[model samples]
Target: MGIIQSLKRFFSKQTETSEKNHDQALQSHYYKMTKDKTFRELENFFSEKEGFEIRSVSEEHGEMIVKRTKGKPAFIVVTIIMVRPFRTSVDFSVASETMLFTDFGSSRRLIYGLYEELNQRLTFVGTGLGDELAK
Candidate 1:
């Protein structure tokens, strides 16, 4: 919102999707489903992508680490957790590999793109429902 904050974000090399994030597009997305289905779908989703690579997958922890090898390299960690039955939460952490400190919002854009693609394959409920949904 402010000039300093804008500059900091612009110069940052990483961005993560969280519920409390000020940017709506960067907020964690909620889905009405289970972790198993989400995990499988995500594995397929990234594996099918041209520039992305599934580096590691841990269904036990509901986490996946992926790397983007082409065009502006970046390492992405996708966390998928089922808060409760039929209510799952997905969050993303992206770190860009570049000469400068900034990725010019590329990390944020990548997360947004992932969310968009997953929204199409899964049942999206809402974003930032950790407090209210858990109860």
Candidate 2:
């Protein structure tokens, strides 16, 4: 009985360690994705293209907030959020002051393409996220 209990405890410890490692990997991946210079440039490019000035960008939290002035009495604020998990895939969302947009395929593709372009310009150090946006 004691031997069986010891085995159970060992397995439980191993499972916990595995989970922790997976979490760390996810965090590292997220950090790499956010810290990529290409990604940063793309974010700025998008903000400018949309005529919104970026207010702040939180790479650790994977959030970007931008503000735009749309004439008198109308103001638009946009937020870009990313969710990445090691065990799963990366996800992205875009929201405006008034509405939540769920269509990500096109947006993701655009981002990925921009990253690719930057990578080419920079000699392709790799984004560590190949084809992730395509999926």
Candidate 3:
């Protein structure tokens, strides 16, 4: 029983670490049919979110940087890639406000929240979601 419990703990921590370090763009349904539309929708979501301060938006590059003002403050990079003329891919990356490894899970949860709102705001193109985002 002790061994089993230890294994469970180890697996749980490993899962958390894996989730804490992965790219979520490849399998999220947040992809839109158009870059402009996708950007506009994300703009609205990020702008209105409490504690979210959008720093920059590069339409040409289809990317935006948002600073979270809540806790220790972190920078969120939102990137949109146009797969095709009508197929857009949106991805997010969160950086520490300081060069510290303190992003144990808050940043991730924030991303999850963003995706949830995005999924709701944008027309659900498909029901699939990245593992982390699915939670």
Candidates sorted on TM-score, descending: 1, 3, 2
Per-candidate TM-scores read 0.94, 0.30, 0.68
Residue 76 Cα positional deviation in candidate 1, in Å, after optimal superposition: 0.4
The number of the candidate with the highest TM-score is 1
Candidate 2 per-residue lDDT, tens place, 14-102, comes to: 11111112223211122223334534654756565545466666666545554444421112222223333222212223222323232
Off by over 4 Å in 1: none
Clash count, one per candidate: 0, 0, 1
Q: Compute the lDDT of residue 16 as modeled in candidate 2.
A: 17
Tens digit per residue, CA lDDT, model 1, 1-135: 789879988999999989888888887898988889888888999999999999999999999999999988999999999988988899999999999968999988888888998888899998888768757
Q: Write the per-residue lDDT of candidate 3 for residues 3-77, one digit (tens) a residue.
A: 875455333311121222333322434465688998898898878888889999999988898888987587777
The local lDDT score (0 to 100) that residue 3 gets in candidate 1 is 90
Off by over 4 Å in 3: 1-29, 98-100, 126-135
TM-score of predicted structure 3: 0.68
